[model samples]
Target: MENSIYQVYEDEIQSLEEEIKMLAEKYEDSQQESTFFSDEEILMSMKSFQTEFQGELKGQESPSDLKAQLESLEADLSFLMKFTGIWFTSHSKKTVEKTGSRTIQKHRLSGNCHSLPFQLEFQLLEIKSKESVSAVITDLNVIMESGEYSGVSKFVSSTEEHGNLLPFFKSLSSYAEWYEHRRCTFLHFKTRYPDIVKLPEGLLGDYIVLRNPEPSGFELMIVWKIHVDEDGRTTPVLDLLTKVPEQVLEQNITTIENAPTCFRSMLLLFGIETAIENLIKVVGLKK
Candidate 1:
């Protein structure tokens, strides 16, 4: 009789244990279901909260006070970012402008083939964060001035290359490797008056070079090693090997990097703040 009672107790305890496990699994599933939030919903919530908060803030403070508060908020936002600033571009103007011209002429086997020479110029405007650098390229309309090209202007990349041609030909990869092999660091500007060649100051690494000059320009290659300072200035380690002339540039060259650079792509993959943070850390800057 005692044995039978003990057996009954054991069976009851086992049943209870199984029940507890099932309950735990069910609770976990429910929690997971409840925790999942769609991106759209999250964005909507943020917008709603911002609107409501702004409404509540509006008449509660004077105009000057509000302005001061907004400025403070902006400063706080900036401080929260990891890295901010733009690096002036470094380029080798010779090989690009020259190579582009030679390639075009060489490919023009037929009498009807025309050689349209163009130039691309770049200026780093604002480094919103490590990842996103906002820049303005002038003279975007000159690509289709001559030759059999009709819609050449529209066929350019945002970074200012000859549309898909460079990638199609794999010229970019080749040029990047070539530049790296030569230990080149700066982008050489082989133009007339402003013969400024941009160079980086910190440890140089392989980088994609994008070009967008006013009118139209072919995308050429540029390799740079970038660094950012505490004062927010981007310093690049200069490539001491490459050199160009200060003389008048009479060569009609057409080379540009119309595709976006590696830096820009990184921004797209990660948040701007996150990208800058990585860049800052890489450059040996403090948080």
Candidate 2:
């Protein structure tokens, strides 16, 4: 039974590694295609289509030609949905009668990123009075029902990014990607070293405690945190917390204090598993 459980964790690690690779490739493809996440990009696409439609109308007055053009536009919109994992439920545009020349369009969209669902509502304004056309987004609101991503909730309540939707989506994907990566990594190590590692709060928790095989009551804790900035950049921060016995602390105060920084440098040069394994060996040698 114990062997089977270990196999299960190994399997999950392999699966997560595969998924991470797939996600990276897919996101890169989306970026290369320039998924329309910003109002400015959308505006440029809309203007291009508008110009093409006008030329087509002047050249070919046939209803069949117009239907074909509409079909092409629909296909482009479908590509946008597939690339960004976003789907629009309602989209409408109207010319402000009072303004006489301004166009205001409202959009409602919802989508799932890495299985996390979210909704967005916003308005796009196009100013045609100036010689240069510009797109402005306003009244933007974000809704994420799932509490799995706490960072998303803070974004939903904050007004800082209400006018911009690009960062919200970008950060959401990045943070969730890192979260999954951390969970997989922790699970893999815990299952591999069940006798040495302890997870006080299950696999979903942020920190894992490692104890040597000897009953010296010495412990090393690894804390992993995912931080998302206001600009929607996601970063992973790792720290080492040692709980050394009084005797050991007094005997080797320098090693206990220097372990954290050395571990970080090892993480840069050798990676997580080797760094952790080396630490385990060092602690296991203490008699």
Candidate 3:
């Protein structure tokens, strides 16, 4: 009877193991499908937001309506940030002087710039317990370098809205990482495909323009802009320009389909090496 009971327990355990394995396989498959669908959905949502934002500007939409749209866009972007595992934490420090005492708390996030990891720092001045805060961002710093260039650039808020700083911090961090990734990608591309990719001369103002001269008379110009949004945050925007007219072009000229939805999304969809390779393919500049 003891042996029989032992055998029955062993059988049950084996059955449970098989069930768990099946469930695990199903979960992995679901996760993979979800990832692909989520990427496309996010890209489409961002493109739609950019379009509506442009229209609102042209139509002179009311402040309240614009604010609502901006809020919605921010929420969507925050969701993307969380989904991609790009997050921030609050940092606090207390300072005491002969004159007065002050506390400084900032939101900080970090990412990799090629081989180097860097942090973005942001702070809001004059905070109270629960009152609505309307003051501009005290400081925004990107501590990262690309090639020989290394320094911090201060960013000022582009909007006057007073509220939480999480959205702004997330957006700025996303943009900073995107810029770094693009710079790294450009460096790699130049090294691998030196003949096809050439950076422009002189100052370009937050834009990296690469020119590819085709055998034909027309040239292919790929422009990547570190675009600042309504909330005074930045993101990478890509545009493909050729001599061909809208009717002749294969894709929409003013759309972000040429670019990743965000830096985190780029990394999630394609790791650093694959992302660059995919960019080359998307731009149709591969030799």
Candidate 4:
């Protein structure tokens, strides 16, 4: 009976080892893909696994033996989770200057891909109890630049709803990653065909003005609008403007079908591949 019990424990451990190895390999493979599991999901899974393992080992092995095995597994899990592409896993936390009797904690996560860089910040108000704590996404900015085409886009959460910091952090981190991926794709295209593709210039506020090469002295303006629903879901709306009244009258300034090939390609980089369709649907643009 003693030998059989030991064999069972050994078999369970071996099975867990195999599972961990498979997860690690999947994590590695996902890095090269466009879509992968979010960091929050992966971390939560690791935590759940840890809890289950602890419960399974309790009363099954000597206290010392359980502690040693738990520590080993935890260390391995931590290492794996760090490389799972979650920005929060590598975030930095610092205490900001106190305001009156309230203390503030600032956590920041930042990353860049080539010329595109992004930063997400969370400001937490520390209280006496964890339940009284509150956090908000203070800043979310992504800057993309290639030659004369450079713009800084910022994300603003509409509602002032404050709650646990973990969910907010996860959402912002995921947004930053998505922004980076979109920027990287845009940069790749811009780099490959520099002469053919030119970035819009004179970007001010939420609008970009591009000098139309074909029409000589004509400029195309692109406007950006972000809509945040009650549920905190964000949708991007794009609009186009032109100084020439005749183009508007003709209803053919820059329809998706009639847009410059390079311009159309650049719009795909903005995380809105169907920008023209969105502009038409949302803004009621004809043609």
lDDT per model vs. reference = 0.34, 0.72, 0.51, 0.47
> Which RMSD does model 2 reach against the true structure?
23.1
Which residue pairs collide, candidate 3?
Answer: none
CA shift of 125, model 4, Å: 12
Q: lDDT order of candidates, best first?
A: 2, 3, 4, 1
Candidate 2 local lDDT, 162-234, one digit each (tens): 6866677777778767777878888888888788878897877778898887877689998877777666778
Error (Å) of candidate 1 at residue 165 is 39
Q: Flag the better candidate by lDDT, 1 or 3.
A: 3
Compose the digit string of candidate 4's lDDT tens values, residues 1-287: 99999999999999899778756755554443324567698668656765666645555664456557877987886665465444223456565645433556566666542223444566666554446654344433322232222221222232223432344344344544544544553354346434322345311233444443344334445655443333434444455664544655355545533554544455766445455333323322222
Model 4 misplacement above 4 A: 1-84, 88-161, 192-197, 200-210, 215-217, 224-230, 245-271, 274-287
Name model 1 segments beyond 4 Å from true: 1-4, 30-35, 39-239, 244-287
Instruction: Output the TM-score of candidate 4.
Output: 0.35
Per-model TM against the reference? 0.20, 0.57, 0.33, 0.35
On the 0 to 100 scale, the lDDT of residue 182 in model 4 is: 47
Task: Give a tens-digit lDDT track for model 3, residues 19-39.
Answer: 787667556645653453455
Root-mean-square deviation of each candidate, in angstroms?
25.0, 23.1, 25.3, 17.2
TM-score of 2: 0.57
lDDT assessment of candidate 2: 0.72
Give the per-residue Cα lDDT of candidate 1 at 194: 21
